[model samples]
Target: MSYSLQKKLVIVSFLFVPVALLLLFLLYPSLRLLQFSLTNWNGISKSFNYVGLDNYVSAFQNPDIWKALSNNFLYFGIHALFIPLEVMVAVLLNNKLRTSNFFRSIVFLPYILNGVAVAYLFSYMYNPINGPINALLETLGLESWIQNWLSDKGIVNYSLIVVSLWRFSGLHVILFLAGLQSIPNDLYEAATIDGAGSWKKFIHITMPGISRVMEIVLFLNVRGALQVFDIPFLMTQGGPGLASTTFTVYTIQTAFKYNNYGLASSLAIILMLMIIIFSYFQGKLFKGKGE
Candidate 1:
């Protein structure tokens, strides 16, 4: 009945649902996953024996797991290589070029589009027969350049990487654009008066100003690379002999298809640790450079 009591009740009411949901969905499932990682449960058996760190050891010793992890690294490396270009494009967009607004929408449109739809769309585009890509290559009289985009082991991973880039590059660009805009224009003016060229201004002023955004973008890249699933799963099914299979995809197959939930849980744990470790080192490395 009192004002303070009412306020306290209101605060508790607001916090109660979210905190309860977090505990139920996120925290409980995570604890179960950790428990599962230490067992030999085949997922169907209610009677699961705790096998200690055996599953963890098996994940490391498995060559297929290593191969899938390599695919993840490929995605990470390719995306990392493109961050500078994405940043440059963001800078260009920030300059308010002619048709920049139109281009901004166009660049970001792919990211908002449905991921499953994009994968299926690209699947048709990359079809060896009657595919637009091959059609265009044939039109250009470059038949030799046209090959199985999603089938060839050598090219399948790259094809999936292309899809990942298409889906996420705009997000990175938008983030950078926001970061760039936050930078004071007066700094640019001062640099201009000091006779600083475009490249020098980018290096000295722009880089420092948007360093925080850069860190965020890099962390996202690492997470995205590691967790990339739908594109590869829907497109190639991590197929053409596990060529395009990523760590996430492998983890899923291990649990559902192979019915080895214990091993899968271990792999999942390793993945979480990897993301945390990589993000930590990346932060430290960037922080060192920042200093």
Candidate 2:
């Protein structure tokens, strides 16, 4: 073999292991989940029969699934607030103020903490009787504001959303911060020279510069919102009713709590499809705008 052929062969040899592992671990299980969605596998049973599209039909007809899906939408809506909030923080921090580094670290700290730990901490904070939230409310003579944060069906979803925001908003801030840093300083200087104010400069220059990073942030937000499981699972366990139950939480309950693995697999598949469809449309929308 020539030198170029030998080098290419070596590179291919290095790539083979990771590629095989990806297929074996990620792709194989995904395919298996798709296969199981069509069956009545009780998770422990060695033998199962194919049931065609029955599970998918049942999932659609199930009221609980609808409730969980609505909650997913609510979760998505609440999580969407983080994008603007994080972008604002990122922009403010990009001004290169003296305390910017300190504030950035403070903002980014929660994203690195363990999900379970964060959930537990927030659970304690939301406790009704002695939790700091209630205590502070009473201390400020706003006793009426204190309620069972996790138990009230009306506000439990919102309460959990607060926890989600506290944990993940920092990561988005960091992402936006990086995007802001990558923007050429000359663009901002030129805008300044044109007598453009801060708001106008942000609108005409900064927004366009960080558009790609915003796409990534939006995608992550959507995916995280749809797949929200850990915080709700650890904190509320899908709650005092189905009020806080997300699609993922419902899927877990279906599989393990109810011993309906086939149905759970079906739910998982549906979620996968939703994410894929949303992502595809988002890509198309961004591409159209770019063109």
Candidate 3:
């Protein structure tokens, strides 16, 4: 065989394993789920009737599904604050202060911790009776604010949103920090020489410089919000009568708890579609901004 032909064959062989694994693990299961979504499979039996689009219709008509979707949107709203907060921290850390490294490590520490551990830690902290938060409030003579954080329907979602923010904010801070480091100091120096104020320099130079990282951060925020399941599940288990039930949590309950695999599959498909649609729009928005 020719040397060039042998090299091409070796490259093709290297690509084959990953491509095969993707098909087997991802594409194949997705196709099966799509098929299963049209049937009445209870996740165990081989015998299931293909019931057309009934599962999809049922999912749309179900009030719980709608509630769960609304909760997902609310979760997204809470997480949206991370962008600005992380950017602010990143910009401050970018200033070569004496304690910048120490502060950066402190900020990024939470993101490296295990999710379940963080959930349990916060669960204890938010406990109504013995948690430090309530204790501190009482110590300060603010007993009026000491209500059940996880059990109150009105405050449960916000409580969980705070945990999510605390856990993930550090990750965005690191991303923004990386973006900030890539920006040339010359741009800021020039702006300063031109008598540009801090706000003006940030608006014109910093914002434009970090636009690419901003796109990635926004996309991750959207995707993470839609697929949020771990913290809420571990901390609350969609408790207080579905007060903080997310779409993914709802789907898991439908499939395993209720033994409605077909319905759960349909819900999953719907969520996937929603993610895809939102992602498409986000891409367009970012592209327009870049232009």
Q: Whole-model Cα lDDT per candidate?
A: 0.93, 0.90, 0.91
Worst 10 residues of 1 by lDDT: 282-291
Supply the TM-score for candidate 2: 0.96
The number of the candidate with the highest lDDT is 1
How far does residue 78 in candidate 2 sit from its true spot (Å)? 1.9
Measured against the true structure, the TM-scores of the candidates, in listed sequence, are: 0.95, 0.96, 0.96
Between prediction 1 and prediction 2, the one with superior TM-score is: 2
Error of 2 at 243 (Å): 1.0
| Best-to-worst ranking by lDDT | 1, 3, 2
Q: Write the per-residue lDDT of candidate 3 for residues 1-291, one digit (tens) a residue.
A: 999999999999999999999999999999999999999999999799999899999999999889888888888887786578889989999899999999999999999999999999999999998999999999999999998999999999999999989988888998989988998899899999999999998999889888888988888888888899998899899988999899999999999998999999998989889889988988887785532
Q: Cα deviation in Å at residue 116, candidate 3? A: 0.9
Worst 10 residues of 3 by lDDT: 282-291
Where model 2 places Cα greater than 4 Å from the true spot, the runs are: 1-5, 288-291
